[model samples]
Target: MKRRQIYFILVLIACNFTLGYAQNPFEVIEEPLPYSKKASSFTINIIGYNEDFVINEWQKYITDFSGLTYVTAVNKGVVEMESSGVVFPLLNDNKVNLYTRFAPNKTLTGVLLTVWVQKSDGTFFSSESSKKEAERIKDWLFEFQDKIRLLNTRIKYQQRF
Candidate 1:
C-alpha cells in the first residue's frame, strides 16, 4: 500500500511540474510586437514610412528587426527587443510604435527600422493606444529623434563657445 501511494505521489508531482512549465503558445510561434527595449523598465516605439496598414499586414514584416523577438496575437504583435543599457524616452505620445526601412542585409523595402518611446503617461502609466489623438506616431518618432540630436548638437556648440 505504501509503495502504491509513493508512486501515485510521484506521478502527481511530475504532472504538476509539466503543467506549470508548459511553453506559452505566444512565445513559441507568435511574432513579437515591434518595440525596442533599451534596458530594464524602458521601451522605444518604432515607425515606418507607410505607417498605416492592417494589423495582419504588420505581422508579415516583423522579421525586419533582427534584434527584436516578436510574437503575434489576433491583432497585435508583441516584441521582446534587445537592449544593453538604460532606455531613454524618444517621444511622449502614449503608445509605442515600430517602423521599418531599407536594410542592406535583407532585400526588402522598409527593411531597416528604428523605435521611439512615447511619453504621454500623464501622471499615471496606462497601456492604452493613443494613436488616434496623435495622428503621426511615425513622423513623431523621427521628429523626436531629430530634436534629441539637435539638442545634443546645441549642447556641444555651447560647450565649445
Candidate 2:
C-alpha cells in the first residue's frame, strides 16, 4: 500500500524556486468548511500543475522556513514536518506535527492533498490541555492553509499579468 501511494504521488509536483517569494504552482480546490472539534484532518486540493511541481513546492515551503518548521520525515512523496516552539494566539501552548499526503489528481491537473495535525507536545512549558490543544491544532492548520491560499493567489496573478 505504501509503495502504491508513492506511485500515485509521483505525479504531483512543485516548483524549484527559492524561498522569499516562491509560491506553489497550484490552485485551491475548495475553501475550508466547518468541522467538529474532534476533526483533525483537512483536505485541500492543489490542481493544475504537474506531479513533481506541487511536491517540490511543499518541500521548499517546509524546509526554507527553518525556524518555523522542522522536517521530521520525507518518504516517497509524503512529507511530515513538525512545528517549532512558536505558540500561536490559541488558548494553549501545543506544538504540532504537520502531516501532508498528496495523491495525483484523476483529472491529471494536480493533486488531492490532505493535511492534518498529529503527535504534539504542549507548547511553552508543555502544559497538557485537551480542550485548548484541539482548538490550537485546528487553528494552526487553518492558518497554514491560509498561507498557501495567499501564495497561490500571488502565483496566479503574477503568471497572468
Candidate 3:
C-alpha cells in the first residue's frame, strides 16, 4: 500500500509540472542592454575625404569593437550607441549623443571632443550607467583618424576600385 502511495505522489507531481508548462504554451522574455547610456562627443577632422569611405570605416569600427554592437546605431554622421562595462555611481547618465557632419564638397576641418555630468533634477539613472565608456568613445574617434589613413592608403593602391 505504501509503495502504491509513493508511486501515486510521484505521478501527481510530474503531472503538476507538465500542466503548469502547458498552460503557458508560449512564454517569451526579452533582455535589456547590459550597460546604461551615458553621453559624450568626440570628433576626427580629416577634411576633403570621400564620404562613403568615412561612414563605412566608422560603422565597422563602432559596430565591431564595442560590446554594444547589437544596440548601437551608426547612421550618416550620427551614431547613437552604448559600450558595456563598469556601472557608474551617479544617479543619472551623461548620454553619449554622438553626431557627425560633413562638407557637401569637402570643406576643410578637424574634430573635437567634450564630456560633462548632467544636472540632477533627473531621476536616478547612474545605477545603470557604464563607466569609462565616454573615454572609450574618445578613443574610438581618435582611432578613427588612423583607420582613415590606412583606408586612404588602401584606396590609393586600389585606385578607387
Candidate 4:
C-alpha cells in the first residue's frame, strides 16, 4: 500500500508540471503605444523624407520578411495604418489587445505598425515572446532606415556627378 501511494503521488506531481509547462508564462497585454490615445504620440523621424517615401520603404521591408502579411493598409488623409487584425487586436486607436491564440507549434506571428505622416512619428506594436523578438523588430527598422539612407546617398552622388 505504501509503494502504491508513493507512485500515485509521483504521477500527480508529474501531471501538474506537464500542465504548467504547456502554457506560456510571458503574455503581452493589448494597449496602444505611449499608454494613452489622447497622449501625444512619439516619432521616429527619417530626416529629409516625406510620408510617402517612408510608407514605401516599410512596405518593401514587410514584403521581404517572411510570415508577415499586410492585414490592413489605410491611408486616409494624414494617418496611415498597417496590421493583421485577424490574429489579435494588438493596436487599436487607444488600446493594446492580447493575442490569446498563440501556440508553441506556430511558426508565424502577426504585427501592427502605424505611422502618422503629419506628426512624423510612428507606432510599432506586436506580441513578442522574448526581448530578443522586440530587438529583432527594432533591428529591422534600423535596416529599413539604412536602406533609405543608401538611396539618399546614391541620389546625392548622382546629382554631384
Please tell me which predicted candidate would have the highest TM-score against the true structure. Answer: 2
Q: What ranking emerges by TM-score with the best candidate at the front?
A: 2, 4, 3, 1
Q: Ten residues in a row with the worst lDDT in model 1?
A: 23-32
The number of clashing residue pairs in model 3 is 12
Taking the tens digit of each residue's C-alpha lDDT, what string does model 3 give over 1-161?
Answer: 99999999999999999989855412211122244243322334555465556655555654553323222454554434333321222223333222343322223232222123232333221223534443444454556666777877887999966
lDDT of 1 at 71: 33
C-alpha local distance difference test of each model? 0.34, 0.51, 0.43, 0.41
Q: At residue 94, give the lDDT of candidate 1.
A: 24
Q: Write the per-residue lDDT of candidate 4 for residues 1-161, one digit (tens) a residue.
A: 99999999999999999988755422322333456443222223344565556556665654443213342334332434443322211222222211111111122222222222111133333323233434433454455567977987898999998
TM-score of 3: 0.37
Instruction: State how far residue 156 of model 3 sits from its true place (Å).
Output: 0.6
TM-score of 2: 0.41
Which candidate would rank higher by lDDT, 1 or 3? 3
Per-residue accuracy of model 2 over 67-141 as CA lDDT, tens digit each? 265457766655555555333345343344455666675565656666555444422211133545554544544
Backbone clashes for every candidate come to: 25, 13, 12, 5
Q: Ten residues in a row with the worst lDDT in model 2?
A: 120-129
Prediction RMSDs, each to the true structure: 19.9, 15.0, 19.4, 17.4
Could you tell which candidate, 2 or 4, scores higher by TM-score?
Answer: 2
Tell me the spans in candidate 2 whose CA falls farther than 4 Å from its real position. 1-37, 64-94, 119-161
Using lDDT as the measure, the top candidate is 2
| Lowest lDDT 10-residue stretch of candidate 4 | 97-106
